[model samples]
Target chain A: MYLRGVKELSLTRSEEDHIKAIHTLTRRDGRAATNAISERLSTKASSVTDMLKKLAEKRLLKHEPYYGAKLTLKGEAVALQLVRRHRLWETFLVDRLGFGWDEVHEVAEQMEHVASEKLVDKLEAYLGHPHFDPHGDPIPDKHGRIRQRKTKSLDSCGPGESVRIVAVSETTDGLLRLLDSKGLRIGTTLVVQEVHAFDGSMDVKPKSGSAFSLSKDVSDHLQVEPS
Target chain B: MYLRGVKELSLTRSEEDHIKAIHTLTRRDGRAATNAISERLSTKASSVTDMLKKLAEKRLLKHEPYYGAKLTLKGEAVALQLVRRHRLWETFLVDRLGFGWDEVHEVAEQMEHVASEKLVDKLEAYLGHPHFDPHGDPIPDKHGRIRQRKTKSLDSCGPGESVRIVAVSETTDGLLRLLDSKGLRIGTTLVVQEVHAFDGSMDVKPKSGSAFSLSKDVSDHLQVEPS
Candidate 1:
């Protein structure tokens, strides 16, 4: 009964993707420009504008053209549901289905759109109420409560600093595969050996592997806690 | 690698629904009229015509006005994929997610559209490659192979006949709930005490329960094997 009372909001898969992209893009500033949304979703700015207008009319978000857009409380709730579904399915794919951490994201992306309150709650129970997803991101509970952790992107670590990989933010397959290839995962300890100033890449040494240089794009997606 | 080599076919939710409906309608004769497809989907015939044309162009089906639409080989493959996903998810919901047989269909309906071949293959394995779903429908394998059973509708049993429930078809919530109230499920044993020829309703007694009259609608969905 945990997922009870959440109506099956009939939003297209594209709409849900748009809402999630907006939420992530505006996470820091609390608003995201149409162009930023377009960039995140890999769509055109004009299409983003049209979708924003439609979403605003649906009262899921507030769109102010020439400026940016932010989720209304209703939109935030829906986004939380999407997030909860995504993380729960990710956990199931890895923990139960025996999928490698690097291979779960794309499948979970499709699974997350299956909107059933009962299904989500049942899966949560089946997974014994996991607090975090396989990617190390917090899995929101039924009430949209997320466990907060003091973690920063690996790019923020200075030379000689040792930290534990707590989460991976942008979980694209390439980044995950890169982390896999480097023997880095959630809880993997690594020390920053050097910082390349020209491209902002870092030479990091994992506890069990030789030191390697990771580009800014890869390092920026990695979140870590001081070890 | 089980689900490898299957391209993620891009089809909208509405398009998939239309294709599934047509697949069911044309299943008997390998052809279904547009009006029949529209009626089954509860949509207008003109709209069905438009969709049929689109599906034909996509090579999912062959449509001719005033004639019936028949699924092309490609269309049958896609429809079988949908069926495979539906039955597999139904098994997961009931057998693993702890959902009742009656409560899983709607959720599985949403889940069946998740077009991830890897997820489907993983789920099939996770469920130990279940042969039949909770409602007694044969779950299609990775190659769209279904297990056939020799079962007949409960309405087909004559008076004084004994039968065991094998499967339930047309699993509407109302019908399943009705069966649940009557303490009937897969493998439940029952005896047909009397059959009303006028209406085809049967008065049957479960192995443990007293006799009850089931309307033709209810009996039609109940598949039974001779006991």
Candidate 2:
């Protein structure tokens, strides 16, 4: 299930989806409950229990009676495939389809299950092997390799520190609208000029070969390799 | 070539390649030269002439007393986009990757013309809405829509006339081999009959509910109506 790089991994789409849901839910909550999985997958709890057992047998998830399950290394492989395809497709949609960054995540979700290594390889080649997708998520290379980026929230940028935005989170159009109003986007160089403790927001500037200030909360989700 | 049932009448990848070359050459040869075009495309001269005149009045190819010029609205939209992506990557290979797709015609040649709709949608979806790439294929969807499908091939049926195999023209290793061997595949039916041919193909009995004979060609192509 864990493709070290780009060799094909064997698992059905549903299995991968279950693994991914577990991974996501685990990231949010401490454990992956059967109810949580049923809610995420829109399936009956009974069905989730059935799948939990099936995955446990495959050593994909460590299931504990009444508690839920944890993804084993084997399961992690499958989850990673969903992640890889998800980000890759997101990038392709926004970059190649003329989609706004806010519009790509959902579409990529559906496209991620397409079964074709050659298609993915060709896309990577066609795309110059991009390292990120539309929402600023890192794309796993054919080898499932990820570039370790040193980044923190825009909120973390101290006054007088220079920062350039590499990506924005695509959760809602609200973020996109806010950024657009502020002229902030990936690779936009903005320096922290001042932070108002009174309102948790700040003044911002664009990196258009110029200096500027930005609000603090908006900066939190934005990753900046501060200089 | 006109694909049956393709209402989308966009100039195909091959058609665009022909247009680009024809446009450039029409400036030479005193006009568009069919023989030269045939040499360029490695197709026959007669086919080139047929396509040239067809394109000319359509405004893609220019022809005057066997002489020619360039594109028109109907032609340039498709031609320019194809040219834009092809040259962008062709140039990118030499400039970025030390080695291209063979230095890349084998792959690029095919990719250069894959339907822009699919390419743009998938690319933007995967690449993070990159506005531009090293190759400069305009890295965004010039057109907003893409066509996605769930169709499969027809080579996986048993000795029967009506069993729908689902899926089509797969380039994968498992599928190609399976189809070649007349084993498990997609949308394929055996149509029970004793071909009793001299060329050594199997002839199975009972078209449905049982297995029988098959021709290699029949086993290789032919998609069935959906079941």
* Candidate 1 lDDT over residue span B1-227, tens digit each: 13223365688888888888877777645678887888877899999889988898988887777897887777777788888899998888888888999888788888899887778888899899889888888877887777898999998898888999989877778889999988999999999999898998889999997998999989998999999
Candidate 2 segments exceeding 4 Å error: A1-10, A27-50, A65-68, A209-217, B1-227
DockQ of each: 0.73, 0.08
- Candidate 2 DockQ score? 0.08
**What does candidate 1's lDDT look like per residue over A1-227, in tens digits?**
13333475689888999988887788855679888889888889999999999999998899887998888877887888898999998899889989999887777788888877778889999999999998899988998888999999999889999999989986778888888877888999999999999999999998987998899998898899999
lDDT of 2 by residue, A1-227 (tens): 34654344566768878998998788668789999899888999999999989989877789998988898876776677678778876776566556777666555665676555655676677777888876566877766667768788788766778877777653567878777766677777776778888777866666564545555556677877775
Pairs of residues clashing in candidate 1 = none
**Candidate 2 displacement at residue B218 in angstroms:** 8.7
**Best by the lDDT measure:** 1
What range of 10 consecutive residues in model 2 chain B has the weakest lDDT sum?
Answer: B132-141
What is the total number of backbone clashes in candidate 1?
A: 0
Error of 2 at A193 (Å): 2.1
